[model samples]
Target: MIDGVRAILIGDATLTGLVSTKIYPVSAPQKINPPLIVLIRKDADPNKCKTESGGVGRLDEIDFTVLIMSLSYGECETISERIRFLLDGFQGISNSKDLDIEYETEFDSYSEQAKLYVKNATYTAWYKT
Candidate 1:
């Protein structure tokens, strides 16, 4: 599920044109360039059972935190907006895996150590495994 979601986000032309292959799954590299995206799985819980069988389900409600980091605030905002536009309310098959994504705006801030602008977007992704 994580790999499928990462592939979908990384395959976006707008995002790739901006940051290329700088999309990290859990953590970014020690020395990362500006305008990168990091995907973190914040929390996950099993969805309500459909059948009477207790553990016979394949769906999960997963929350992901997408962090957009850039050198300037404007760039960060633009990238974050593009990511939201690309991912919000998206439902389809990615890499032959079934998934549904619903996103919400989280928060934005600035990092003093790296001198980077940061934007965090939270997504509720329902994945079938």
Candidate 2:
């Protein structure tokens, strides 16, 4: 099934240590699959508009989203091996439940992270713990 990872993930602490992600199709068989992690950060302003009729402004969370994709077929045959292979060389993120992330801007916490590794074809979803 196409699993959905819904999280207002703070940019930086994503798919690092104990946190894992997996993505699979709905028609596919069920397995002990991890969730697929995708972090979408909103770099724009929180709100810049005014109310029109209702006067009830549409409030939005001044934060970004953490997307965790699902698993697919064929990969299951070698999921274990694949997971191991991908972990190679990559440093292990701290096992802290808190997002041990640091920002560079005055409000860096609001800025999320999105990194794609072509060599591994796997995406990294970063967020605070």
Candidate 3:
């Protein structure tokens, strides 16, 4: 599921041009990079509601935190804005699977250790299993 989401983000020309294949699923490497994108699964909850046929459905509420790290806050903000434009309210097929974005939030932060600006974008995605 996370791979599908990553594919969508990586496939976007605008986003790819900025970060290339620097998007990480869980966390970035130990070596670290100045400008990169990180995808973190914050939480997930299963939908208890059954299907119309009285069978279980593959519905889940998955929350993801997408981080855009850059040397400066302005650059981070710019990349984050492009990411938001590409992903906010997106509904489509990724890796031959259907996914829907339910909600999203974007914010800013600082990485004291790395001394980099972090733009955090959180997304709530609904996946139909």
Best by lDDT: 1
> What lDDT is obtained when candidate 2 is compared to the true structure?
0.29
TM-score of 3: 0.88
**TM-score (all chains, Cα) for each model:** 0.90, 0.21, 0.88
lDDT of 2 by residue, 1-129 (tens): 002122212222333332332322222134443434333444423333345564544323222333232343332223323333443233324334212122221111111232211112222323221
TM-score of 2: 0.21
* 1-129: candidate 1 lDDT, tens digit per residue: 777778887889888998898999999998878889999998988765564565666688899999999998898888888888878878899888778898866898989998888999899899876
Off by over 4 Å in 2: 1-35, 54-129
Over 4 Å off in model 3, which ranges? 48-56
> Tens-digit lDDT track for model 3 on 52-120?
899878778899999889998888887888777777788989998678874477878897988989888
lDDT of 2 at 43: 40
- Candidate 3, residue 101: the lDDT equals 79
Better of 1 and 3 by lDDT: 1
- For model 1 the local lDDT of residue 104 reads 64
- In angstroms, give how far residue 91 of model 3 lies from its true place: 0.8
